[model samples]
Target: MHRVIISGIGAEIPEPVITNEELVASFNSWVDTENARRADTGEPLLQKSDSDFIVHASGVKSRHVIEREGILDPTRMSPRIPARPDDALSLEAEFGIASARKALAHAGVDGSDIDLVICSASHHQRPYPAIAIEMQEALGTKGAGFDMGLGCSSAAAALHVAVNLVRAGAHKRVLVSTPEIITGHLNFRDRQTHFIFGDASVAMVVEGLAQGEKRPGRFEVLDTRTWTQMSNNIRTNLGYYTRTAQEDPYMINLEGNLIKQVGNKVFKEVTVAGQKFIVEFLAEHGLTPGGIRRFWLHQANARMNAMILKLSFGHDVDHDRAPMVLE
Candidate 1:
């Protein structure tokens, strides 16, 4: 089996940063007005949120959103990205192509060298045309392309698959791009998770290293493990066929289509599950937690990562040990 190495990496972040202060102010203003309206109708008032509370809860001080003006608007707290023509590249594909181009350049390889293109992300722009295929066409690559979704772990899962394909000699080079347009699915009116997600695309070039290849500076994929369990703690209730009888069958609304998460349940369950997986994964490979130099964990929450590391390592790890990028 050939060894797989990560030759290069690149990222594409949308412009216009939305600070937590700005979001909280707009959200609270909307909440106050909504509450006043509800009071007139004898309905329960909506709760107000604070910036400090948001930061402490999720450790997200700000985020990069695709539509800055519309999301921050008190009236319409949603992204207003216009739809593109069928022939034009979708927004997700545009970002994916930008990141993939940078990754290919960094790898010192052209698009022709990529044997496969994998578009793994939290969500896709459309259902008919696979984004991976569109990316392949845009890059002028002559290989197969596909899409995969694993929620928040989509990129890691895709990396695992790319590594295996390269090791098995199925492909000499693979381009994995994760373009997360998460804000499009978020209900900004909902205070629980409005401040969680951001917009960005990350790309990586994975290539097979033949015997005696002297790539001294490249990083090798030693091992990877993934596990899945049935749970509804985090989910979105939306699909092409799902619809209310009273509403149009094809019309998608934000009511049930947006992301819904049980914060407490997810925090507890994922902390335990993540720690167990890391411990077992390292142990299986004859490695220890302390021996690992750096831990680039998922950019979720600061407190959650801290707790998971503490439980797994039997000690408290500092920021240097586990760096966070959610902010």
Candidate 2:
């Protein structure tokens, strides 16, 4: 098997930041003040203390969109959301392709040399050809293009697939882009998770273990693993969409307890998870995190991240300004 290393990483974040105030206003106008207020109010299931709330729980404070130049009415999004899912795919495609092209340039790889294309994200749904097909056309990838969906774990999972493809003699060079446009799907009316996310596309270039294909200075993947159990089975709660699957708004839902309620139990599994998998994967490959310059725990937002960081690194490591949000 060829050892793979991340050759380059690039991301595109749209310039838009729709705040909570704007969303509440739109909801008020659409559903009347008295009715909307009654609907949103209840026992605050989140944040026992302000400290418990994730900095960006909603997965949005602001996000990028073509016509989102100023304050926006949630109900009256411009260009009019198409009735079909495919149209939204293309809309997302525009953002994905632009970000991918930028990623190729950033990685210093000519599009023609890309042996495989992997496009992944947690938001958006399409009815026809695969989303990756659209991305392939955009990036001019003549090798292969496929869409891989794995929830928020999509990016890391893409890396695993890309590496395997190279090892299997499928593709030597791989380009993977994770463009998450959660705004269309997110439910900002729920204040808890509304603060958690930002829509952005992060891309990466990886190469097969070849003597000649080496970036001058690159951080190689020392080890990796997945706590498969962490993948939620049935998404009963959501911040990605609001209202029922029937409600017209069709926004995302953020169930804060998805992490909060299960926080303690999961931490027990995670405590030795890194050390366990790291030891095994490294022992098998002859490597270790200690040998690497840094380690990242694919975490997003603030609160749960704070808790996880505290459990994993303790007071010794200060994740106060880590690039975790970009993960």
Candidate 3:
């Protein structure tokens, strides 16, 4: 098997920060001024100690990109002042670029070197060209590319796809990206699924660059396994646009509590499978969990991260580095 190593990385997020105050003001004006005031009824999470164990999480704080302000429904309502040009790419595309640039920068490689570009995202509706083409044009790449879907696992699976392409000789360099802008399709009235997602994207690069390169990096492609159970009939899925919210087309929906109950249960029940995934991932190089240096899991909240870490390594390991408490 050909060896595929991570060589260079880059990322780009939207120019919009949509700070809490701005969001509160914007969201308030959209709804009845009375109901808009409710958006902040729940105390803003930003005020709480960053170290406090998270509870009653809501999706509207921290960081996220907005297409524009003052023009709530740009597609329909033409606000006097328009949105910024960078917002033209839409939130998903914006987030995709965010991590793409970071990953490229990390690998010390420019976009020109990527031979294959893979976008693991779910919020694109343009039909003239695949988002990858626009991404390539954005990065100025002349590479073969495509897009894939796998919900929250899209990021991890994109890595697998990059390694496979390198090992199969289809390409020598690959850049994979995963981004979500679910808030674009959110229905504020649908409290069942609202208030759980933040917009973001990340990019990673794996290449067949010569092994003797200057800086050190990571390698090894184990295996990827997917499982579907009763929850598939109920919980577990992606966040994108909703026809129901067509008037508010850009909003995204995330079934927070539903995901929590189902995900926590899966975290508990999937221990054997999770361990097996670990075992198989290591068997490729005669290694195991102890041999690995990091575990980057995307937990929705601190509570979820704490529970999953306990499952993966008990409650003893340092989790400061884990990607937890997003949203």
Candidate 4:
């Protein structure tokens, strides 16, 4: 059996920053307009959103976006990314390549060194051709590549796959990249979730180590576990097969595909499942909560993460021990 280790990591964040104040203002204006329209139809008015309320609810003070102009626009409250030509590189592939290059550079290796590439994310730019292959071409890697989508757990799932590939001797070096442009899927006009997502790309380099071969400062891959249960609390209903009976079924609409979640259900389900996984993982490895130095959780919600950490560790973990990037 071989050991797998993380050799390098890289991240890329889009330049545009949308602060909570800006987001709240835009959402509130939309809400006011919506409420006025609803009043005309005898429908209930929508509640106005506030920056303070957003921060308190999600602990997200700001988020980075790939397109700032369109998202901030009062009318078009969504990302304004145009479709690319077939010959052009896809946005997700471009971001993935950039991050992979940095990871390769950090590891002092070129594209030729990688034996596999895995592009994983919550959202993908296209439904075909696989962004992983596109990134492999852009990075000039000879290795094979594929794409994986596992919702918010995609990155962890990709890491698990890479480590297993290395441990199985099927690959020597693997690059796992997550180019998440989640803002595109957000219904910016909806106050409940408009402030929750951002655009960014992250990449990790995993390599197998043989006996007597050591790479200093590399983090070992201990073990990974994933669980799946049937739940519609968090889901998106967007795909080619989906159809609406409306006349303008092909018209662009956010209501059908945008992320929708039952907040309370998701909070409870995720926390319980996450806590169980942690307890089992640590126990199987003969480790305790105090043995871990840092816990970098998914950057989803501050409250959810804090509670999950608290439940798993049997106490409240300080900010330093469990840092968050959701903000």
Candidate 5:
């Protein structure tokens, strides 16, 4: 089996920034209007969102978004990104292309050098025509292209696939691009999840190593593994069937279909699961937590990551131990 290494990594972050204070102001305004309507029917008033509470709950102070026009608008609590014509490149593909170009450049290769392209992310804008194919055409790449998703693990899963494909001689060079436009699907009015997501695109170039090849600062792939268990704690019900399954097929129901999660349950369950997975994975390689120099964990909740690392190491972990990029 051939050895594989990550030749390059690139990231493209959205320009529009949304602060917690601004988000809270818009949410509180909507809450006031909603409560006023509920008052007449004797319905319980909705509690106003606080910026301080958001910070205390999640370490995110601000987030980048593709667009800010409708997101900050109290009437519409979602991003308003205009749809492009069919002849034009897709938004996700366009974003991914930028990151891909950077990664290709960093790898000292061109688009023509790539043999495979995998576009993976938490959510895809569409189901057909595959965003990876679009990106491949735009980048002038060859071979096969496809798309896959594993929620928050999409990037890692894509990398794993790329490495294995190279190691197995199925592909020599693979480009894995993750374009996460989460703000577009985020429910900005939900207090528990409003500030949890942002918009960004990242890409990595995985290639088989030649004998005696020396690439400085490259990450060599030693082993890869994936584990999954059924759980509905973190999920989104919005899908193609969402509109069709409704009684009024033409009507849209955004509630209960958008991203909604049991935050507390996810925190507790994932913490234990993460710790166990880390320990077992390291043990399988005849290593321990102390043997690793750094940990670049999933940037979900700051507290949850800290707790997981603490449980794994049997002590409190500082920022240097497990760095975060939630904000």
Candidate 6:
């Protein structure tokens, strides 16, 4: 078996940005319109969203999105990404490739050096013709490519697989590409989830290391493990069947199918489970939370991460100890 190291990392954040004020204005406009329409129906008026509430709730001041015009348009609450021709490079593959190229450049290798490519993301534009395979061809990479998703853990899961493959001497180098255009699946009309997600793509190069060989500025893979338990607190029912379920197959339903979540449950459950997992994992390596130099926890929620770190370390952690990329 060989040792594996993360030789390089790269990311592509979209150009367009949406601040909480802009998001709230759009949401509240929709709420007002809906409330006006339901005035005589005896239905309760929809509550207006506030930028301050968004910040206090999720700690997100702003977010980068792949598109701006559509989402900001008070009439429409979704991003307007034009569908590309099948023959042309797809958006997901394009975004993944852009990040992958930077990762390859950082690793001092070409796309051809990557024997395997795994495109893992929270959302995939299509089910077939795997985005990874499309990226492989576009990058002129050899060997095999595929796509996989495990919700928010997709990128980490792909990295775990790449590390194991390199450790087993199956491949010299593997690329894990995550192009999450999650804003597309976001329900901008929903006050609870409107300001939560942003679009970004990231890539990492996992390579094998030989004995007596060393690479500076690279992280050595110590150990990798995953724990999973079924929960529906966070979910999205938008899928192929969504179109089929509609009375008109051509008509799309944007109400309940998009992303929705029980934020309180997720925050509580993840914090408890995440802290226990971190403590146990560190203990297995004869280490403690305080012994670690840095912690790169998920960027889902700032408060949840703080609570998890606090629970694991038995005290509140500093911002420098666990930097956040959510905003």
Candidate 2 — worst ten consecutive residues by lDDT sum? 43-52
Name the regions of candidate 6 deviating beyond 4 angstroms.
none
Model 5: ten consecutive residues of lowest lDDT: 51-60
Local distance difference test, candidate 4: 0.87
Task: Flag regions of model 1 displaced more than 4 Å.
Answer: 244-246
lDDT, candidates in the order shown: 0.89, 0.59, 0.56, 0.87, 0.91, 0.91
| lDDT for predicted candidate 2 compared with the true structure | 0.59
* lDDT tens digits, residue span 1-327, model 2: 777777777878777555545544554454453354555885323312122233244222334544342225545433234554544447667677777777778777877878788888875556347677777776677777888867667888888888777766778889888888655554444433333445678888887657567566776664455556553422325434435553565543343423222333444554456446545665677665444345565555344445544444444445444445432
Clashes of 2: 29
- For residue 290, give model 5's deviation from the true position in Å: 0.6
Can you write out model 3's per-residue Cα lDDT over 161-200, one digit (the tens) per residue?
7788787788888888877765554443232333345466
lDDT of predicted model 6: 0.91
Off by over 4 Å in 4: 244-249
* 1-327 per-residue lDDT for model 4 (tens digits): 688899999999888999999988888888888888999999988888898888887789999899998998888898899999999999899988888889898888989888899999999987789999988888888769999989998999999999999999999999999999998888887767788889999999999888888889889887877778889988888766455644687774546577887778988998899888887889999997789999988887998899888898888998899998865
Assess the local accuracy of residue 246 in candidate 1 as a C-alpha lDDT between 0 and 100: 32
**C-alpha root-mean-square deviation, each candidate:** 1.2, 6.1, 7.3, 1.4, 1.0, 1.0
Q: Residue 86 of model 2: what lDDT?
A: 46
**By lDDT, highest first, what's the ranking?**
6, 5, 1, 4, 2, 3
Candidate 3 lDDT score relative to the true structure:
0.56
